[model samples]
Target: NVAVILAGGVGSRAGFSRPKQLVKLGGLPVVAHTIKRFQSHPLIDEICIVSTADHLEEIERLASSLKAHKVKKVLGGGTERRDSSLAAIAAYEHEALSGPLYLIFHDAVRPLVSDEVIDRVINALRHYNAVDVAIPCADTVVSIDQVTNEIISIPDRRSLRLGQTPQAFLHDTISTAYAAALRDPPRAHTDDCGVVLHYLPSEKICVVEGDTYNHKLTYPTDLLILEKFLQSNGGRRKVADTGDRQLTQLRGKSIAIFGGTSGIGEKMAELGERFGAKVSIGSRRNGVDISHAPSVQEFLKEVVATHGKLDAVVNSAAVLTYQPLEALSDEDIVSSVGTNYLGALHVARAAYPYLRESRGHLLFFASSSYTFGRAHYSVYTSSKAAIVNLTQALADEWDGADVKVNCVNPDRTATPMRTRAFGHEPQDQLLDAQTVALDALSVLVGETTGCIFDVERR
Candidate 1:
């Protein structure tokens, strides 16, 4: 499949000197980031960025600056979006694109778009001839007259969808649709899917649930929110260590161990390495700033690039609480949730591509206290409970994807965090961290998800 990026529009709303797509989100140009994602996709065969004739020089410079090598051609866009799309179609035909070509059209302004979404669009296009990525309207939608303030129609919000790019199509189907549009053009629409809907039947148009995080950058104020998002979700390139050893049993497979440098995570890495699977480890000590979403995102991309495939993931990293609720600051809660709950979510999202590719297993480290309800461990327990709930929800949602999601609830593991929570206790009641690690690994090694393994040596 070949991907085409629409970078023609001058985003006047963003108030930049040029198009908003060229604006920087983090360090790279927003369009550059979008292009890199498709470039990184294993299934995508080629990439072409369609920009304005005036912007072609700048876009070429931007691509070179970002080291975007997968982009085979950089062409000029048309007067309108339809024209811009036709320009891309012409470019594909010029190349004599052979075989069953799948075409994906993306908005360059949406920098946060994930590889998972791109894969979904590709998978959809393979089976169905045409599809669009969209989010169902969340708020009550009303259509009002431009002349009068009165409501013209109360549209069913459930049926209404906020269209987004990368809208995908069979190359021939879209080419046909565009050619037909040129004969008797309809009113201008933002997406090619809208153009197709005019000429094609309703059954031909399909909508895939779009991630709300895949937002388009349109305003200056959005930068701050995006920055915060980048920070919390893990940045542009965060590294994960996939323990891949040639002599290991699962040598060809890939497994991820969160906080693998220490505690149960370290033990899991050892086992995974011995099992012959590539293990991806996330550690704060390794310069991974999960507090920043962009950093986390970057780390995940690094892990995927390193392993080339991901077969399993076990989040053995977590924070323990010591302060009372009254004494705890917002910083404390942020640190705990950022590492224990949200950090896991970020890793999961980042590792999604590998899991989808491998149809692998996902394991979370929860706590018995989360379910048993212990005192003075409010924040820690709360975070674990969130993981448990998330594991359940993700498992339910991943029914179509064939990936397994589950968690391990350990009662008391003697790790550094446990020492911080209990203060140098020489108690035999605590279970060995390695023991918990093996139990979690067993669940992943097998095929089980949405189940929490309670490990308490009582």
Candidate 2:
């Protein structure tokens, strides 16, 4: 893969003394920062900078000052943006270059393209054969006649996506598109995607959601906003001294599911194990009893001793009641609440210290009835609701300690409890317990720390 940065733009509109690409942002030249970003990427074989004839030498000097690697300078200054872009494309097609490679065309003015976004675009191009990064247009737009300057019609912005770069393409796909454009270029076309869509089939173009901060530095005022964004996100976007582009990999991350024998708990364990996590499956048959407090505590201790650390704990084991309000005696309420609500609390509390050590996550399972009160399940619903509040309170206390507490309120899942509540059916397409558990697992692994996720997996 190769990254082509179009740094040949003249900042006439911005009225800056220097080219916009050379404008200092966050104490570094904007194009220098942009090249530095991709220079370290493992997938990016080389980084080529297309600068105007006047600024080529200065751009190379700026790169040298930054100690940027994997950079090659190309002399280019065109009357139009498309011409400069084509020059970069030509450098990508040189006889010395590799054939059928993935090429990413990015604007040097947009210096906020993080390593994560670059990796994502590369991954998409590898998978889909062609892809473009874009953000959905958030404003209403009107189409006007060019001659009369009169509004013709209001276009639906909901279906419109504002294109951003690095627009990824196959070496052949982009090479062919630009070759055709040079032969008979369209007067109204602006971006590379426009050329591709005009010449290539519609199915050839694919869109990926782009970051909102990835805006082109078109005007003078925009540079100030870009600088501010860089200052705020400097810690996250700054290139490492080693120039390694690999972000934090999820290897050796141990996620132990307490009560991972069946239902949602079992599904979560399977996923944890699948994602290269050291999964410790706990079940009564395996001598990890969920009913008795002492036995449960001892089992948890064993897990902690074995793993030496825990990354996440998902407590999906719960007891349910199906009796009507009148038929639900105090014993029924006590049994249901003690096992479902108290069991969650016990597991979370027992794992709190271990979780704090690793900044682990604690996930609880609640029923959708906790939100929508249903008939004949008052005791179960109330018990689950208590778990929700427990999660909130625990999250509040553990906020500063780096421990996350969250709950999943699943609806009508195809589990043993669902059969007890809704009874047997010929063919009821209820939510898949595994799907719900996996979705909740993803949430637990993500940055959404404290919240109740109402999941319905159909």
Candidate 3:
């Protein structure tokens, strides 16, 4: 398994005098975190980094300083992103790398990539010749006529997906495609995926799930968010993604799902039981109003009393308002905020004692909508954003007690609530609630804390 991390961009748009990849993000160059993610990955054997000519020395020095044994070399990149990727591919040929090699290319700007994202790309190479990573687009995208400044077409939001990296490909296949692409000087594709699609159209590219936190550093605002998140996260050892082992770990353990009557919450309850868990559902069906603190406290107390002990508390409940902010009634605004943000907090605070006693976990739900902060969904997006920050804060606060707090920012999922909001979308297009529930089960048994995962794709 070979990984090539692209860090050669000028990043003039970022308003940084230096290259954005070299810019300090939490006291380390942005590319360092990206390299370390692969270095720490169990499957990755060797790393080859590509950066600008001027920065290659510093990059090499940084890698050496970090005592990275896996880094094969730090080579100078070309004028374009594709050129850099081609450079790496050329080097692989020069080195006489053996046949049936799996190659991965990732943007250094997206420094917060998780092991699961890396694992998915690597794992897919077993069956797929080419693999791409992407999250479902949250916004309705439009294709406009550039010259006329008119809307040319409105594509189905369900079909649109926002692309991300590390894009994995069979080395021999991509090498041939890239060699053919280099023959055409007039053509330039934006990403490696585009390169594959254009030159290797006959090959099918499998799209795996991508993390929302696997964001590229483009603007100053992006840098601020990335820096703050990294600083807050500090450092922790990562847990291996042990598939069905999570089920065995949860067996016979008690868990309370605050919104476990419908949608993701209800499904988690069923999965928990199927995995041999003692599951308790806390929702309106059980007369528990999560928005109210006292009600949450009393209900959790009852849950613990009934179930013996609580191992994990997951809050999957949320409410949203899509109308104009000013037009929204004060009641609707408060209800949205209270239900989405405070409701999770109410559960977290109330369940902390039981979780602390068992050294268990706290899981919360966020939406990809939090990323865009789109208009008309101010209260909804703002509250979800607050939940993300709150997830980290609670993790920090509970660090001493060994309780892990994490958030899964799922893209559009097929649920009763989403159906009411986004009418008539094919159910098959949306993410299944059970998939997210299974992810939540792993988080419960995992070692990491203060992590935010994207549950966007299959």
lDDT of 3 by residue, 1-458 (tens): 88899999998888998999988886679998788778768799899999999998999998887667799978788888887888888888854455677779999999988887888898899899899999999988889999998999999989888999999888888898888887887475788888889988999999999967788899989998887557334222222232565477788888888888888888889988998889887787778888999999998898788988988888988886677798999899889988998888788889998999999989998887875687887998888888878887887689778898998776677888877766679776777777777777777877777777766564
**Which residues of candidate 3, in runs, are more than 4 Å off?**
94-97, 231-458
Q: Candidate 2, overall lDDT?
A: 0.73
Best by lDDT: 3
Kindly report which residue stretches of model 1 are placed more than 4 angstroms away from their true locations once superposed: 94-97, 232-262, 273-419, 422-458
Instruction: Please give the CA lDDT of all the candidate structures.
Output: 0.75, 0.73, 0.82
Where does candidate 2 have its weakest 10-residue lDDT segment?
A: 238-247
Q: What's the distance in Å from true for residue 416, model 1?
A: 5.1
* Model 1: per-residue Cα lDDT over 135-172, one tens digit each: 87899988899888989999888788888878988777
Tell me the tens digit of each residue's lDDT in model 2 across 1-458: 77888888888988998888888875568887688667656778877778888887898887776566677655575867787777766766763254567768899998877666787798788566578888888898999999999999999899998888988888778778878877884567777778788877653677877887786888888987886555333223211122222212335676667668877788767766666677787666687655567766787677778877777787777777777889978887777776787777778778888889998888887776775566778777887778877876787679668798877776667776667766885435567766676677666656545466666533
The TM-score ranking, best first, is 1, 3, 2
User: Which scores higher on TM-score, 1 or 2?
Assistant: 1
The predicted structure with the larger lDDT, 1 or 2, is 1
Instruction: Name the lDDT value of residue 325 in candidate 2.
Output: 82
The estimated TM-scores of all candidates read: 0.60, 0.51, 0.56
Query: What's the CA RMSD for each of the models?
Result: 12.1, 12.5, 9.7
